[model samples]
Target: MAATLPQDIKLHTKSRTLELIYSDQEQFELTAEYLRVHSPSAEVRGHGIGNGVLQTGKQLVGIKGLEPAGNYALKIIFDDGHDSGLYTWEYLYDLCQEQENYWNRYLKALADAGETRHGNMIAKG
Candidate 1:
């Protein structure tokens, strides 16, 4: 079974990042660009499997605000004016736990697909 989110969740926003503190004392500091491009919304993640979109031009983005969505999720607002994507507790936890691996995989995928995260040039597969 999935673990339930802690009752106390605190978010500390910096100039270009967000620090998430869980009740268990686990902490994760994520950049706004990472969070923005990796959003779980349909626009980014798509509605079903194998429909993900490539998010580009988010290398220097920052969080504009954080809004609570009941007790299960948070609506993260970005400095680029994106305010969708409700990040559930489980998803957030997974993101934190798998941060390093996910980031590496993302970078590799970008290279393999010849797609740059900053939209510079398309790579040939």
Candidate 2:
């Protein structure tokens, strides 16, 4: 029994969420916007550590396509024309597990950059 393979995967387009059930019966609901902004692609995640791009204006981005990449990952195509990320099963699991910490960091980064999740800039004092 491997935790690397998803037992079931459902894409709820209307809600913009990806539901995953693992082999161990663990379940996770990952949002499209979360997947989009935190894409494993270098464009979003960066090719090196601490070089990730701060994605904004993706509050409404949708998942256009989901194609399997061998038995390791899935190739996600976003509605905004981003198709570079190869989201492996392990990566997805990590996203689900560390979602809270990661999201918090993202929000803090946005606020520090004076930008909102919608890409709007905030006025500084």
Which candidate leads in lDDT?
Answer: 2
Worst 10 residues of 1 by lDDT: 116-125
- Report, for all candidates in order, the number of backbone clashes: 1, 0
Candidate 2 collision pairs: none
Position 41, candidate 1: lDDT: 90
**Which TM-score value belongs to model 1?**
0.80
Best TM-score goes to which candidate? Answer: 2
Query: Per-residue lDDT for 37 in model 2?
Result: 85
- Cα lDDT tens digits, model 1, 1-125, are 13646445444455577776664567678777678878999999898999998777677666767888997788998767778899988887788889988888778877787877674422221
Lowest summed lDDT across 10 adjacent residues in model 2 is found at: 116-125
Model 1 gets an lDDT of: 0.74
Q: In candidate 1, which residue ranges exceed 4 Å CA deviation? A: 1-14, 23-25, 119-125
lDDT of 2 by residue, 40-76 (tens): 9999878799888899878777787799999889998
Alpha-carbon error at 41 in model 1, in Å?
0.2
